[model samples]
Target: MIIKPRTRGFICTTAHPQGCAAQVRQQIDYVRKQPAIQGPRNALVIGASAGYGLAARIAAAFGASANTIGVYRPGERSGGRTASAGWYNSAAFETAAQEAGLKSFSLTGDAFTDETKARAVELIRKELGQVDLVIYSVATARRTNPRTGETSTSVLKPIGQSYTNKTVNFHDGEVSMVTLEPASEEEIQGTVDVMGGDDWQMWIDALREGGVLAPNATTISYSYIGPELTQAIYRQGSIGRAKDHLEATAKQLHEQLASGGGRAYVTVGKALVTQSSSAIPVVPLYISALYKVMKEKGIHEGCIEQMYRLFADRLYSPNANEVPVDEEGRIRIDDWEMREDVQREVAEIWGRIETSNIYELTDLEGYRREFFQLFGFETDDIDYEADVDPSVEVPNVSA
Candidate 1:
């Protein structure tokens, strides 16, 4: 099959295997050229197929020389569709990890379930022995309670009143106004149940109980706190309420792990083009504007760059006795993204941005390129003209 990008709204329906592999390799190459990290020796990354989760896995294996196990729900091929970009990405990552003589493995299915958690613990015990670090990076629209079997589907909406904001169609650089209604309490609860830290806590409790966590171990889950422009739709929205639960869970788990001389933290990450972020109503426009400002200022950092720094700078800094955190005990890699000057400039553009000046005022082109790159498309190095296989497999994940 000669696979090309097929799109419907915010998702890409097809994935190019070689293009996805190349994307993984580019990030690996970038990590390889940098100084090695003083981080974890054994790691497990939940939702480790794409976006921030994938970057964290790459950083753990390549940057910190850690043996890693990844948990993810891979993309499926239905009729004419190709396997997801994450499937290709995992296959490529495993291929590289093995070629480089690093131990790597992956498991597929919902990371929100007990069966998945139990099986992951078993893999850790059987293969890697114990993990000193765990990165919980799963972001899903729905979750089923392992005990109750109840399903909760999350919604991205404001918590109170309606949220009206300027947005963009990065595909064609058309700016528009969107008004998202406030979520009901039920909707907010559902969002929290799906995206919150309950599952993260469950994973930690399972790992600790199964005795697969190394002594003095640490765990971190990814979170986001964008600028005030996005506060209504993001930080102060239903998802923000979920983040509140997630951050609170981090503190709760921190105490649980403390008995074993271990710890946990929530890392507030920067917003970029990701599957989850793209679905949010007003964030893409904000990210596009942010990209223009940050890139021009020469301080733009993607998932891989941010994860590498988290490990190298704060998480494993020799200058600190333990991982340093903010006043609320959360790690902040969103610093550059939340800088006052950056926000001020983005706001200036946000005020005057329209259809005509979108390209001039924002990085919508860059945003589109990165968005396509998420699905293994729009990469110059991959020949879209060539025949390709869509029935690709991740070589390391039999389970």
Candidate 2:
């Protein structure tokens, strides 16, 4: 079936399989071309189908030469519809790994569930023996707590007081003020429950109990602390409360793993045109401006570049033990994004950006293209009008 891009606000409901495969190949090619990393020999990436999670897996496998197992819940093709972009991504990744003679496996299920944990443990024990690196990068709007049997849905709203900000409809470059009411206590807690580090902690505990975690393992999770421009809707919002919990969990996990020389870290990344970021108010506009500045300055780093740097430069350098971090003890890969020059220029753009000059002043076009690229659309390598199979199988899906 020939597939084209289909979209609702901030989401592409349809994905092109061949295009996804091409994008995966491009990432793998990029990693292979760069200097090899002295990182993990075996890795497990929870939420390993898209975004930073997928990029981390590629870097570990292609750059660090690690065997990797990925865990994700992606939609399957049904009723003549295409599978989720993540599904095709995993399929493409597994195929590339096989070609490269790297051991790669995909496990599809809810990463929050006990059953998925058990399955992962079983897979690790049987295939990789132990994983020295574990990356927690799950992004979801809702989560069902295995311990409590209750579901929590996350909301993107500020805390304490309402927030009003200039936001853009990236589709048409319409700039307008968006006012969001503050989240209630229940809503704030719910967001924390869904996006917090509880699931990450549980995964670590299960891995340790199952003896699939290497004694000297290093585990990292992704987070974002944008500049003051997006602080209210992001870092100081309901999601921010959850991230605070996540950072706290990193500390606890560090203590818990310190006995065996393991480490836990939160790597704060730069804002990009990810599916999740596109959903947040004011972020897309901010990212559009940031992208223009960074691209012009030649300091732009995408997920693949960021993940490779995290492994080579910070996590496993010659002085790996002395990883540089902020006062909060978290790695700041957002260094370039938060540079004084970048933020100053972005602030300048924010002050006067409106519908009329948004296109001229920002990289909204680039932002839109990347957003489509996330769903395997608008890619340069594949013909969208050509017929392709939507039922592509991930070569190494867990039995």
In terms of lDDT, the best-performing candidate is: 2
Task: Report how far residue 281 has shifted in candidate 1, in Å.
Answer: 0.6
lDDT tens per residue, model 2, 338-395: 9999999989988989999998999999998899999999899688778888998888
Give all TM-scores, in the order shown.
Answer: 0.98, 0.99
lDDT (C-alpha) at residue 371 in model 1: 94
- The list of candidate 2 runs beyond 4 A from truth reads none
CA lDDT of each prediction against the hidden true structure:
0.91, 0.93
Model 1: residues with Cα > 4 Å off, grouped in runs? 76-78
Task: Point out the worst 10-residue segment of candidate 2 by lDDT.
Answer: 312-321
Q: Once model 2 is optimally superposed onto the true structure by TM-score, how far is the C-alpha of residue 246 displaced, in angstroms?
A: 0.2
What does candidate 1's lDDT look like per residue over 187-297, in tens digits? 999999999999999998899899999978989998888888888988899999999999999999889888879889999999989999999998999999999999999
